[model samples]
Target: MNTTNNIVPAQVIALKKQRVILKTETNEVITVNVSKGKKKDKVFMLTMADLLRSGLWIPVNRTLRQLMRYDWLDTPVKSYAF
Candidate 1:
């Protein structure tokens, strides 16, 4: 199954090693894979884990490199560039 697409699914996988199903507005559901350790030069994810350990899951709403920043497990994909 394709584990790429929605950011939420990736984030869920990043936070918890539990794969989840996310329904996109396009009426498509995607499945994600949650792996251990760091991949894709995962600096943010490593930091996120640290935050989680310190009981901090609220930073996900902030922007990257800002005072507080959180992002999906995978780097956000831009346009498909058809």
Candidate 2:
């Protein structure tokens, strides 16, 4: 079985302290941690590992495009282009 096929597409709806809220294409909402660290630090972008662990997947192309639109997110679009 291909695990990738089970991955669901979701959009970042809101950002909270060390957490990211996402709404799926099917209208399901999910909350995921931004970092695995202990400190209460700020996070700019979500990592591929974090998304996968949270059962979410945002395509690289869409991530790059959205990165531009969500300027508050710190990081170059090229980083997600991969």
Which is the leading candidate under TM-score?
2
Whole-model lDDT per candidate:
0.36, 0.51
* Model 1 stretches astray by more than 4 angstroms: 1-14, 17-39, 57-82
Candidate 2 lDDT over 1-82, as tens digits, reads 5545345567667666666667668776666554555224323344433554666446322222222224323456777755
lDDT digits (tens) for residues 1-82 of candidate 1: 3422213211222344433223334434344333453434467556556644554323221111111223433445572244
The TM-scores of all predictions, comma-separated, are 0.26, 0.43
Q: In model 1, what is the error at residue 2, expressed in angstroms?
A: 34
TM-score of 2: 0.43
lDDT, model 2, position 26:
76
Question: Each model's number of backbone clashes?
Answer: 0, 0
Q: How much RMSD separates candidate 1 from the native structure? A: 12.3
lDDT of 1 at 58: 33
**Candidate 2: stretches off by over 4 Å:** 36-82
